[model samples]
Target: MSATEDPAAETADDFPAAPPLPWRLDGSARLGVFTLAQPMEAPSTVTAVAARRLLVFANSYRGGDVSYDALGVATLARHRHRVAVVPRHLWVDDPSIRRAGREQASTPSDPGSFAWSDSSARIASGQASVELSWHVRTRLALPMPMTFTYFVWDDGRLGCIPIPGRATGSPITMRINHWPDHFPELAAYESSLALRLNFAMTVRPQRLIDSK
Candidate 1:
Protein backbone atom coordinates (compact mmCIF):
# COMPACT_ATOMS: atom_id res chain seq x y z
CA MET A 1 0.00 0.00 0.00
CA SER A 2 1.22 3.50 -0.78
CA ALA A 3 1.67 6.17 1.88
CA THR A 4 -0.92 8.45 0.33
CA GLU A 5 -3.33 5.57 0.29
CA ASP A 6 -2.63 4.96 3.94
CA PRO A 7 -3.30 8.07 5.99
CA ALA A 8 -0.73 7.03 8.58
CA ALA A 9 1.99 6.69 5.96
CA GLU A 10 2.57 10.40 5.36
CA THR A 11 4.50 12.12 8.11
CA ALA A 12 7.31 14.73 8.17
CA ASP A 13 9.30 12.00 9.96
CA ASP A 14 8.97 10.08 6.66
CA PHE A 15 10.65 13.04 4.96
CA PRO A 16 14.23 14.29 5.27
CA ALA A 17 15.26 16.24 8.40
CA ALA A 18 18.35 18.22 9.33
CA PRO A 19 19.28 19.69 12.76
CA PRO A 20 17.23 22.86 11.90
CA LEU A 21 19.60 25.67 12.86
CA PRO A 22 17.65 24.32 15.79
CA TRP A 23 14.62 23.96 13.47
CA ARG A 24 14.70 21.50 10.58
CA LEU A 25 11.92 21.91 8.07
CA ASP A 26 10.39 19.46 5.58
CA GLY A 27 7.78 20.90 3.25
CA SER A 28 6.76 22.21 -0.18
CA ALA A 29 6.92 25.81 -1.37
CA ARG A 30 5.95 27.86 -4.41
CA LEU A 31 8.16 30.67 -5.65
CA GLY A 32 6.12 32.40 -8.29
CA VAL A 33 4.06 35.54 -8.79
CA PHE A 34 0.33 35.92 -8.54
CA THR A 35 0.34 35.43 -12.33
CA LEU A 36 -3.19 36.73 -12.67
CA ALA A 37 -2.88 39.17 -9.81
CA GLN A 38 -0.28 41.63 -8.74
CA PRO A 39 0.27 43.83 -5.70
CA MET A 40 -0.33 40.71 -3.66
CA GLU A 41 -1.26 41.02 -0.02
CA ALA A 42 0.97 43.33 1.98
CA PRO A 43 0.66 43.06 5.76
CA SER A 44 -1.85 45.57 7.12
CA THR A 45 0.87 47.57 8.83
CA VAL A 46 2.88 48.20 5.70
CA THR A 47 2.94 51.71 4.23
CA ALA A 48 0.80 52.61 1.23
CA VAL A 49 1.30 49.75 -1.23
CA ALA A 50 2.05 50.14 -4.88
CA ALA A 51 3.68 47.88 -7.48
CA ARG A 52 3.07 44.16 -7.21
CA ARG A 53 5.60 42.13 -5.24
CA LEU A 54 6.85 38.56 -5.63
CA LEU A 55 4.54 35.97 -4.13
CA VAL A 56 5.64 32.91 -2.13
CA PHE A 57 3.74 30.16 -0.30
CA ALA A 58 5.05 27.35 1.89
CA ASN A 59 3.54 24.81 4.26
CA SER A 60 6.15 23.58 6.68
CA TYR A 61 6.33 21.84 10.05
CA ARG A 62 7.61 25.16 11.46
CA GLY A 63 4.95 27.38 9.83
CA GLY A 64 4.58 31.00 8.57
CA ASP A 65 3.45 33.02 5.52
CA VAL A 66 4.92 35.16 2.71
CA SER A 67 5.45 38.89 2.14
CA TYR A 68 6.51 41.46 -0.50
CA ASP A 69 10.17 40.59 -0.20
CA ALA A 70 11.94 41.83 -3.33
CA LEU A 71 14.46 39.01 -3.04
CA GLY A 72 13.61 36.47 -0.29
CA VAL A 73 10.30 35.16 0.98
CA ALA A 74 9.37 34.93 4.67
CA THR A 75 7.66 31.56 4.30
CA LEU A 76 8.48 30.77 7.93
CA ALA A 77 6.44 33.06 10.18
CA ARG A 78 4.35 30.99 12.65
CA HIS A 79 3.42 33.85 14.95
CA ARG A 80 0.79 35.73 12.96
CA HIS A 81 0.35 39.02 14.75
CA ARG A 82 -0.64 41.69 12.20
CA VAL A 83 2.35 43.13 10.40
CA ALA A 84 4.84 42.10 7.54
CA VAL A 85 3.63 39.34 9.59
CA VAL A 86 7.25 38.31 10.07
CA PRO A 87 7.93 35.05 12.07
CA ARG A 88 10.20 32.57 14.00
CA HIS A 89 9.78 29.11 15.64
CA LEU A 90 11.42 26.18 17.54
CA TRP A 91 12.20 22.35 17.54
CA VAL A 92 12.57 24.44 18.69
CA ASP A 93 15.58 22.81 17.14
CA ASP A 94 19.99 23.38 14.23
CA PRO A 95 23.36 25.05 14.82
CA SER A 96 23.60 27.57 11.94
CA ILE A 97 20.14 28.42 13.34
CA ARG A 98 21.00 29.18 16.96
CA ARG A 99 23.07 32.23 16.04
CA ALA A 100 21.01 32.53 12.86
CA GLY A 101 17.78 33.92 14.20
CA ARG A 102 19.32 35.29 17.35
CA GLU A 103 18.06 38.73 16.43
CA GLN A 104 14.32 38.36 15.74
CA ALA A 105 13.33 34.74 16.19
CA SER A 106 10.24 33.81 18.20
CA THR A 107 8.18 30.68 18.82
CA PRO A 108 4.46 30.18 19.16
CA SER A 109 3.20 30.68 22.70
CA ASP A 110 0.36 28.34 21.83
CA PRO A 111 1.25 24.91 20.39
CA GLY A 112 -1.81 25.07 18.15
CA SER A 113 -0.12 27.80 16.09
CA PHE A 114 1.99 25.31 14.10
CA ALA A 115 -0.28 22.29 13.91
CA TRP A 116 -1.79 21.24 10.57
CA SER A 117 -2.05 17.49 10.28
CA ASP A 118 -0.62 14.14 9.10
CA SER A 119 -2.82 14.10 6.01
CA SER A 120 -2.86 17.86 5.40
CA ALA A 121 -0.53 20.90 5.49
CA ARG A 122 -1.03 24.39 6.93
CA ILE A 123 0.24 27.13 9.25
CA ALA A 124 -1.78 29.83 10.89
CA SER A 125 -1.52 32.77 13.25
CA GLY A 126 -4.18 35.36 14.14
CA GLN A 127 -4.36 37.43 10.92
CA ALA A 128 -3.01 34.88 8.39
CA SER A 129 -3.28 31.24 7.33
CA VAL A 130 -2.25 29.08 4.34
CA GLU A 131 -3.19 25.53 3.40
CA LEU A 132 -1.12 23.67 0.83
CA SER A 133 -0.88 20.51 -1.30
CA TRP A 134 2.49 19.67 -2.85
CA HIS A 135 3.45 17.43 -5.78
CA VAL A 136 7.09 16.43 -6.14
CA ARG A 137 8.65 16.32 -9.60
CA THR A 138 12.34 15.61 -8.93
CA ARG A 139 14.54 13.83 -6.41
CA LEU A 140 16.38 15.46 -3.50
CA ALA A 141 19.74 16.92 -4.37
CA LEU A 142 22.81 17.78 -2.27
CA PRO A 143 22.66 20.67 0.15
CA MET A 144 23.50 24.21 -0.96
CA PRO A 145 23.22 27.71 0.38
CA MET A 146 20.06 29.82 -0.10
CA THR A 147 19.78 33.47 0.81
CA PHE A 148 16.68 35.68 0.89
CA THR A 149 15.49 39.09 2.02
CA TYR A 150 12.16 39.47 3.76
CA PHE A 151 10.57 42.88 4.33
CA VAL A 152 9.31 43.03 7.88
CA TRP A 153 6.67 45.41 9.21
CA ASP A 154 6.12 45.57 12.92
CA ASP A 155 5.57 48.13 15.71
CA GLY A 156 4.64 50.65 13.00
CA ARG A 157 8.06 50.28 11.44
CA LEU A 158 9.25 48.39 8.37
CA GLY A 159 12.64 46.74 8.04
CA CYS A 160 14.53 44.45 5.72
CA ILE A 161 15.59 41.05 6.99
CA PRO A 162 18.44 39.05 5.46
CA ILE A 163 18.13 35.34 5.76
CA PRO A 164 20.85 32.81 4.96
CA GLY A 165 20.52 29.04 4.78
CA ARG A 166 21.76 25.67 3.46
CA ALA A 167 19.27 23.40 1.77
CA THR A 168 18.67 20.56 -0.69
CA GLY A 169 15.56 19.05 -2.18
CA SER A 170 13.40 18.05 -5.15
CA PRO A 171 11.64 20.23 -7.70
CA ILE A 172 8.00 20.64 -6.77
CA THR A 173 4.64 22.14 -7.76
CA MET A 174 2.29 23.39 -5.04
CA ARG A 175 -1.44 23.92 -4.86
CA ILE A 176 -3.07 26.33 -2.41
CA ASN A 177 -5.94 24.68 -0.63
CA HIS A 178 -6.91 27.77 1.38
CA TRP A 179 -5.95 31.32 2.33
CA PRO A 180 -7.34 33.84 4.81
CA ASP A 181 -9.90 36.42 3.78
CA HIS A 182 -7.75 39.32 4.95
CA PHE A 183 -5.28 38.17 2.27
CA PRO A 184 -7.47 38.76 -0.75
CA GLU A 185 -4.65 40.27 -2.75
CA LEU A 186 -3.56 36.98 -4.30
CA ALA A 187 -5.83 35.30 -6.78
CA ALA A 188 -5.67 31.53 -6.59
CA TYR A 189 -3.32 29.85 -9.07
CA GLU A 190 -1.71 26.53 -8.26
CA SER A 191 1.98 25.45 -8.51
CA SER A 192 5.43 26.78 -9.36
CA LEU A 193 9.14 25.86 -9.18
CA ALA A 194 11.91 26.40 -6.52
CA LEU A 195 11.91 23.12 -4.58
CA ARG A 196 10.31 20.84 -2.07
CA LEU A 197 12.98 21.39 0.56
CA ASN A 198 14.77 20.02 3.60
CA PHE A 199 16.61 22.94 5.09
CA ALA A 200 17.94 25.01 8.01
CA MET A 201 17.91 28.80 7.80
CA THR A 202 18.70 31.79 10.00
CA VAL A 203 17.22 35.27 10.00
CA ARG A 204 19.98 37.79 10.41
CA PRO A 205 19.29 40.77 12.62
CA GLN A 206 17.14 43.23 10.69
CA ARG A 207 17.86 46.88 10.06
CA LEU A 208 15.13 49.45 9.90
CA ILE A 209 14.70 50.62 6.31
CA ASP A 210 12.33 53.04 4.73
CA SER A 211 10.00 51.48 2.15
CA LYS A 212 9.46 54.02 -0.61
Candidate 2:
Protein backbone atom coordinates (compact mmCIF):
# COMPACT_ATOMS: atom_id res chain seq x y z
CA MET A 1 0.00 0.00 0.00
CA SER A 2 1.08 3.56 -0.58
CA ALA A 3 2.35 5.55 2.37
CA THR A 4 -0.87 7.53 2.30
CA GLU A 5 -2.90 4.34 2.58
CA ASP A 6 -0.63 2.34 4.84
CA PRO A 7 -1.86 2.47 8.44
CA ALA A 8 1.48 1.57 10.02
CA ALA A 9 3.43 4.00 7.84
CA GLU A 10 0.93 6.80 8.40
CA THR A 11 1.53 8.97 11.42
CA ALA A 12 -1.89 10.16 12.43
CA ASP A 13 -0.70 11.27 15.81
CA ASP A 14 1.99 13.45 14.26
CA PHE A 15 -0.48 15.67 12.46
CA PRO A 16 -3.36 16.96 14.56
CA ALA A 17 -6.27 19.07 13.42
CA ALA A 18 -6.48 22.74 14.18
CA PRO A 19 -8.88 24.11 16.79
CA PRO A 20 -12.03 26.07 15.98
CA LEU A 21 -12.63 29.75 16.60
CA PRO A 22 -14.19 30.63 19.93
CA TRP A 23 -16.32 33.58 18.80
CA ARG A 24 -17.47 35.25 15.61
CA LEU A 25 -17.78 38.92 14.86
CA ASP A 26 -21.37 40.12 15.15
CA GLY A 27 -20.74 43.51 13.53
CA SER A 28 -17.87 45.52 12.19
CA ALA A 29 -15.16 45.43 14.82
CA ARG A 30 -14.45 48.62 16.73
CA LEU A 31 -11.10 50.35 16.33
CA GLY A 32 -9.05 52.08 18.97
CA VAL A 33 -6.56 54.83 18.19
CA PHE A 34 -3.07 54.36 19.61
CA THR A 35 0.14 56.35 19.27
CA LEU A 36 3.38 54.44 18.84
CA ALA A 37 5.92 55.82 21.23
CA GLN A 38 9.66 56.22 20.68
CA PRO A 39 11.74 53.11 20.14
CA MET A 40 13.48 51.99 23.31
CA GLU A 41 16.98 50.70 22.61
CA ALA A 42 19.49 48.57 24.56
CA PRO A 43 22.84 46.95 23.82
CA SER A 44 23.65 43.23 23.75
CA THR A 45 25.78 40.45 22.24
CA VAL A 46 23.14 37.77 21.84
CA THR A 47 23.14 34.90 19.33
CA ALA A 48 20.35 32.81 17.86
CA VAL A 49 20.90 30.13 20.52
CA ALA A 50 20.89 32.75 23.25
CA ALA A 51 17.78 34.38 21.83
CA ARG A 52 15.95 31.06 21.76
CA ARG A 53 16.94 30.31 25.35
CA LEU A 54 15.89 33.76 26.51
CA LEU A 55 12.50 33.37 24.83
CA VAL A 56 12.00 29.94 26.39
CA PHE A 57 12.86 31.26 29.85
CA ALA A 58 10.73 34.39 29.51
CA ASN A 59 7.68 32.51 28.26
CA SER A 60 7.93 29.98 31.05
CA TYR A 61 8.11 32.66 33.74
CA ARG A 62 5.89 35.30 32.20
CA GLY A 63 2.51 33.57 31.95
CA GLY A 64 3.41 31.66 28.78
CA ASP A 65 3.46 34.94 26.82
CA VAL A 66 6.92 35.92 25.73
CA SER A 67 6.31 37.51 22.38
CA TYR A 68 7.81 40.81 23.43
CA ASP A 69 10.71 39.13 25.13
CA ALA A 70 11.51 37.16 22.00
CA LEU A 71 11.33 40.31 19.95
CA GLY A 72 13.75 41.99 22.32
CA VAL A 73 16.15 39.05 22.17
CA ALA A 74 15.87 38.73 18.41
CA THR A 75 16.41 42.43 17.99
CA LEU A 76 19.43 42.39 20.23
CA ALA A 77 20.91 39.26 18.72
CA ARG A 78 20.59 40.43 15.14
CA HIS A 79 21.01 44.18 15.51
CA ARG A 80 22.76 44.49 18.84
CA HIS A 81 19.90 46.62 20.02
CA ARG A 82 16.94 45.90 22.30
CA VAL A 83 13.99 48.10 21.40
CA ALA A 84 10.34 48.61 22.41
CA VAL A 85 7.60 50.78 20.98
CA VAL A 86 5.07 51.85 23.59
CA PRO A 87 1.61 53.19 22.84
CA ARG A 88 1.13 56.66 24.25
CA HIS A 89 -2.63 57.15 24.05
CA LEU A 90 -5.68 55.28 22.80
CA TRP A 91 -9.21 56.35 21.91
CA VAL A 92 -12.35 54.92 20.40
CA ASP A 93 -15.14 56.54 18.39
CA ASP A 94 -17.96 55.15 20.48
CA PRO A 95 -17.90 56.72 23.92
CA SER A 96 -20.66 54.45 25.15
CA ILE A 97 -18.28 51.74 26.35
CA ARG A 98 -14.88 52.01 27.95
CA ARG A 99 -12.42 49.63 26.29
CA ALA A 100 -9.31 50.89 28.04
CA GLY A 101 -9.19 47.87 30.30
CA ARG A 102 -9.50 45.36 27.50
CA GLU A 103 -7.08 47.24 25.28
CA GLN A 104 -4.39 47.45 27.92
CA ALA A 105 -4.89 43.85 28.90
CA SER A 106 -4.56 42.71 25.27
CA THR A 107 -1.68 44.94 24.25
CA PRO A 108 1.65 43.11 23.94
CA SER A 109 3.94 43.77 26.87
CA ASP A 110 6.86 44.16 24.42
CA PRO A 111 7.25 45.05 20.77
CA GLY A 112 7.91 41.41 19.86
CA SER A 113 5.20 39.89 22.03
CA PHE A 114 4.06 37.03 19.80
CA ALA A 115 5.64 33.85 21.19
CA TRP A 116 7.17 32.14 18.19
CA SER A 117 7.35 28.34 18.61
CA ASP A 118 8.87 26.84 15.48
CA SER A 119 12.28 27.92 14.28
CA SER A 120 14.53 26.89 11.37
CA ALA A 121 18.10 28.07 10.90
CA ARG A 122 20.15 28.18 7.72
CA ILE A 123 23.16 29.83 6.19
CA ALA A 124 23.14 31.55 2.80
CA SER A 125 25.26 34.10 0.92
CA GLY A 126 27.69 34.27 3.80
CA GLN A 127 24.94 35.23 6.21
CA ALA A 128 23.18 33.26 8.92
CA SER A 129 19.36 33.33 8.87
CA VAL A 130 16.67 32.13 11.20
CA GLU A 131 12.95 31.91 10.55
CA LEU A 132 10.48 31.83 13.42
CA SER A 133 6.73 31.15 13.67
CA TRP A 134 4.07 31.45 16.32
CA HIS A 135 0.49 30.21 16.59
CA VAL A 136 -1.34 33.40 17.53
CA ARG A 137 -4.56 33.16 19.56
CA THR A 138 -7.20 35.38 17.99
CA ARG A 139 -10.93 35.90 18.57
CA LEU A 140 -11.60 32.19 18.86
CA ALA A 141 -8.77 30.25 20.50
CA LEU A 142 -8.03 29.55 16.84
CA PRO A 143 -4.36 29.56 15.93
CA MET A 144 -3.40 32.41 13.64
CA PRO A 145 0.08 31.76 12.33
CA MET A 146 2.68 34.56 12.45
CA THR A 147 6.25 34.51 11.21
CA PHE A 148 9.47 36.55 11.28
CA THR A 149 12.85 36.13 9.58
CA TYR A 150 16.18 37.45 10.84
CA PHE A 151 19.61 37.59 9.25
CA VAL A 152 23.13 38.08 10.55
CA TRP A 153 25.96 39.33 8.36
CA ASP A 154 29.61 38.23 8.33
CA ASP A 155 30.78 41.37 10.13
CA GLY A 156 28.35 40.49 12.96
CA ARG A 157 25.75 43.09 11.95
CA LEU A 158 22.14 41.97 12.41
CA GLY A 159 19.18 42.91 10.22
CA CYS A 160 16.27 44.45 12.13
CA ILE A 161 13.88 45.45 9.38
CA PRO A 162 10.27 44.44 10.02
CA ILE A 163 9.07 42.14 7.28
CA PRO A 164 5.41 42.23 6.22
CA GLY A 165 3.24 39.55 7.80
CA ARG A 166 -0.44 38.68 8.39
CA ALA A 167 -0.64 41.24 11.21
CA THR A 168 1.64 43.85 9.63
CA GLY A 169 -0.55 44.78 6.72
CA SER A 170 -1.87 48.27 5.97
CA PRO A 171 -3.14 50.46 8.79
CA ILE A 172 -6.68 49.11 8.45
CA THR A 173 -5.82 45.42 8.59
CA MET A 174 -3.24 45.98 11.31
CA ARG A 175 -5.86 47.59 13.51
CA ILE A 176 -8.48 45.01 12.61
CA ASN A 177 -6.32 42.15 13.85
CA HIS A 178 -5.22 44.12 16.89
CA TRP A 179 -8.71 45.24 17.95
CA PRO A 180 -10.89 42.54 16.53
CA ASP A 181 -14.64 42.83 17.32
CA HIS A 182 -14.05 46.37 18.42
CA PHE A 183 -13.87 49.74 16.64
CA PRO A 184 -11.28 48.80 14.00
CA GLU A 185 -11.96 52.02 12.15
CA LEU A 186 -10.92 53.97 15.19
CA ALA A 187 -7.79 51.87 15.45
CA ALA A 188 -6.93 52.70 11.86
CA TYR A 189 -7.46 56.36 12.60
CA GLU A 190 -5.23 56.00 15.63
CA SER A 191 -2.44 54.61 13.48
CA SER A 192 -2.68 57.68 11.33
CA LEU A 193 -2.70 59.85 14.43
CA ALA A 194 0.47 58.13 15.58
CA LEU A 195 2.16 59.05 12.32
CA ARG A 196 1.01 62.65 12.70
CA LEU A 197 2.30 62.71 16.27
CA ASN A 198 5.81 62.04 14.89
CA PHE A 199 5.91 58.78 16.76
CA ALA A 200 9.17 56.93 16.11
CA MET A 201 7.10 54.25 14.46
CA THR A 202 9.89 52.47 12.62
CA VAL A 203 11.39 49.36 14.24
CA ARG A 204 15.07 50.19 14.87
CA PRO A 205 17.77 48.02 16.38
CA GLN A 206 19.77 49.35 19.31
CA ARG A 207 23.37 48.66 20.19
CA LEU A 208 23.99 45.95 22.76
CA ILE A 209 26.17 46.52 25.83
CA ASP A 210 29.07 44.20 26.51
CA SER A 211 28.29 41.87 29.38
CA LYS A 212 31.95 41.67 30.14
TM-scores for all predictions: 0.49, 0.17
* lDDT score for candidate 1 against the true structure: 0.42
Tens-place lDDT per residue, model 2, 55-106, is 1011111221110112112122333443322222122111111121122122
- After superposition, the stretches of candidate 1 with alpha carbons farther than 4 Å from their true spots are 1-33, 40-54, 59-119, 124-129, 153-158, 209-212
Q: Model 2 segments beyond 4 Å from truth? A: 1-53, 56-139, 142-151, 167-212
lDDT of 2 at 202: 20
Q: In candidate 1, residue 188 scores what lDDT? A: 55
**Cα deviation of 199, candidate 2, in Å:** 28
lDDT of 1 by residue, 36-147 (tens): 2544334443432333433454434343221111111223222234223233221112222222333243221111134444334555544455565666666657676666
What's the C-alpha lDDT at position 91 in model 1?
A: 19
